[model samples]
Target: NIINARLRGKPGLFRVALNGERIAAIVPQTDVVAPAKGNDLDAGQNLVVAPFVEPHIHLDATLTAGEPKWNMSGTLFEGIERWSERKEITTHDDIKTRAKKTIGMLVDHGIQHVRTHVDVTDPKLTALKAMVEVRDEVRELIDLQIVAFPQEGIESYANGRALMTEAVAIGADVVGGIPHFENTRDQGVSSVKFLMDLAERTGCLVDVHCDETDDPQSRFLEVLAEEARVRGMGARVTASHTVAMGSYDNAY
Candidate 1:
């Protein structure tokens, strides 16, 4: 399945050729043969790059902004509490509908890849199951990567570890954690280590929601980075939402 297109970049027009899903050739328009009729898309001087990649998103919690209740406190904890209530009444069909609808919106925006975190804290693993279904259903339209995210504290939640393990065993593409939400800093560090070990054993990628709060003392990002370095995971590990890093003391 070869396809040809005239792509626009900073300098000038370029002829890009794709074989199946890979770029087989790229040459300046002047040096390339004119693509046959009906086989090319001349971008007409529009900047053409690879499709967008949404590295971090919450598909399970999306489209439920005001269900059950609103976040009166406007804090992450409040939002989590509200979501807990919302998921209590959410059915499988409801989750699938909202997820597919969101995927449609992403496809419309030229987003061809998405890595969505589906909460696996529930005993039933409802969100994880629904996301797995959606990931397969929308495979033709987008590269959907499902992360088994423990939105709650991994060690803090009694069954968090079990649920996350089940998610990986079933079909999750990545393992996720919320170290900043753990009850204590030590627990946070432990959770990061646990998640990294799970990823290593399962050969899955690691993407943790680390240091998302405004507290400058939230240093779980440091632990995550150090562990990734130690394990040689390199780019396969992604520590997202390091909001607290901006507030850290320069000397420290």
Candidate 2:
């Protein structure tokens, strides 16, 4: 238990009890001091909060500002273009080294959990393999969730389906797709269905990069949502970077 804890944005001293790592109870402070116990902590009016959670991050591409070439345009496609070149020259050790350093910074800032999307578009699966190793290596320091993300496209890229299958067979905790990046709208819908079906077959979570483009016409989010709702798997699915939602018309 932590006594004399100051509640954030609240006027009061409180006592926080724990059931293992989770908070079991919290009550207003009564006594000036808590009884001496080896396990108990005295917060001394300091604010306490649970460690931060990083829901979306790309550990594979972290700490690479201008390695191969600069993304002078600062657009998503440009970033992907730079990363494609970077991935070509990046070795396994280089990926692991960069990912570990990035995780170290997250840990120092009180982030205890992280979900990193490792690109699996490459037929070689260089990033996914390297991140899988780093996930196990940093398990003691933080909880790492590795998603097999197809950065380029599922149907647009060559041998995309096979690479995704191999990624999950290896150690990917989640299945990912970039629907907006597909060349055609039909292919985007098919990619969403394919990724959802793959997750079900492999018993993995889904975290798709859906509707990342600024085009309001990109309505793949509906397909993804309907797929999850129809299958009763909404809790196991996530749609990240839905930037098009903001540009969408109010009437629709």
Candidate 3:
């Protein structure tokens, strides 16, 4: 009864050995045990290796489809607007159900860790509360980190900042901001500063959706980078969707 077996040495010319069972020895080429009389066991050259990490992803919006309507504009802003409409109808049960299903999908795909951003712009904090429950429920299968994401602008939407703080109070693992979505440039920059302060106060990681636009003038990423550097929270800060970086001019 061979418990485990692995090939060692050069490809197509390696020694196969079995261990952790009755037979636990490395045999020479000639001494190698052949398959049963008629059974065939092909020794393939290539080997499969396990993954190291799952990196980042959004679990809250994973499986949501056609709630109020579809995003016909195909732009990120339109997606946000569409999501806002859908979010208005979001309930604790709705979020919990989708989150559990999304987590199951991640586990099946071999993802062991995930950093999910749950929108907290709603006053009810439905998604944030549901994610906390899902995180604890699936702790054994997948490691989950929840971000208190202000999908709507922190200052553009009424009571947005308060909702973000409430999410952190309810056990969100990170603080997130959408600076580019702010109504004005100054407000956009200010939102970044405010989110950083919130993270510091709540002792959470900072992840922002900065400069996710195609416009070349979008520069909130620099603001975020500078804020992260000044606060000594560079390592704990992550700037997502910095698409504007592609169009940044070197002269400035």
Candidate 4:
């Protein structure tokens, strides 16, 4: 038997055996092997689980609240607009410092995996570069995945595709979009298609900020699902912030 070690909860009621980094078996506490073998660790009856994962976070925009002012409107649009002003003064060092500190907090909370969306709409790619540096620097402590996100819009923003391409070339791990922020419904649908095509071309995963509004007519998620199904990229695609789903009718 190639058993690596055993993990137990306080008093050893539940036990799990590992092979290398993978779980080999989960046995009862009564069946646990003696710890004298030097591989058994009792976790003191607390909840013993795999490290936590944070799926969606904005590393570039985090810890920048109330820089020039506050988001009095309390809407996503207002937040984005306010962030634009703050972003004007942002530097690579600023992004790296904030991101590293936030990652430290996440690690303290037992989060070993995190996927962060870094804004790529900026022509300078300041945040993307800094995040890539942070990603490599913290690789030993966390699995950090970066998304090349066009927070403004895919088509609505100037040179958005070019910026996104530069972002991935510099080490962004995934493709991202903000379809709900497009100028119109037609533009929103087109943006999703563009992102799906981009993902296929680059062989990157997709995560979109879809319909993060309370409007019942926000249907970008439906388009996103259909595109994912048509392209056979089902599980690899994710639609985040679909708050509008709450307003959907039961029949829908």
For lDDT, the strongest prediction is 2
Top candidate (TM-score):
2
In terms of lDDT, the poorest run of 10 residues in model 1 is: 1-10
Write model 3 residue lDDT over 22-61, tens digit each, in one string: 3355343433344455433434433323433555566677
Model 1 lDDT tens row, 1-252: 122334543465666676776888876654434546887765554556679998888988889998988899999889999998998998898999999989899988889999999988889999989889899999899999999999877899888888889999989999999999989999999999999999999999999999999999999988999999999997899989999988899997
lDDT of 2 by residue, 141-222 (tens): 9999999999999999999999899999999999999999999999999999999999999899999999998998999999
In model 3, the worst 10-residue window by lDDT is 1-10
User: What is the total number of backbone clashes in candidate 1?
Assistant: 0
Q: State candidate 1's TM-score.
A: 0.87
Residue lDDT tens for model 4, 163-196: 8878888988899988888888898988898889
Q: For model 3, name the residue pairs that clash.
A: none
Q: Ten-residue segment with the worst summed lDDT in candidate 4?
A: 1-10
Clashing pairs in 1: none
Q: All candidates' TM-scores? A: 0.87, 0.88, 0.81, 0.86
How do the candidates rank by lDDT, highest first? 2, 1, 4, 3
Global CA lDDT computed for model 4: 0.86
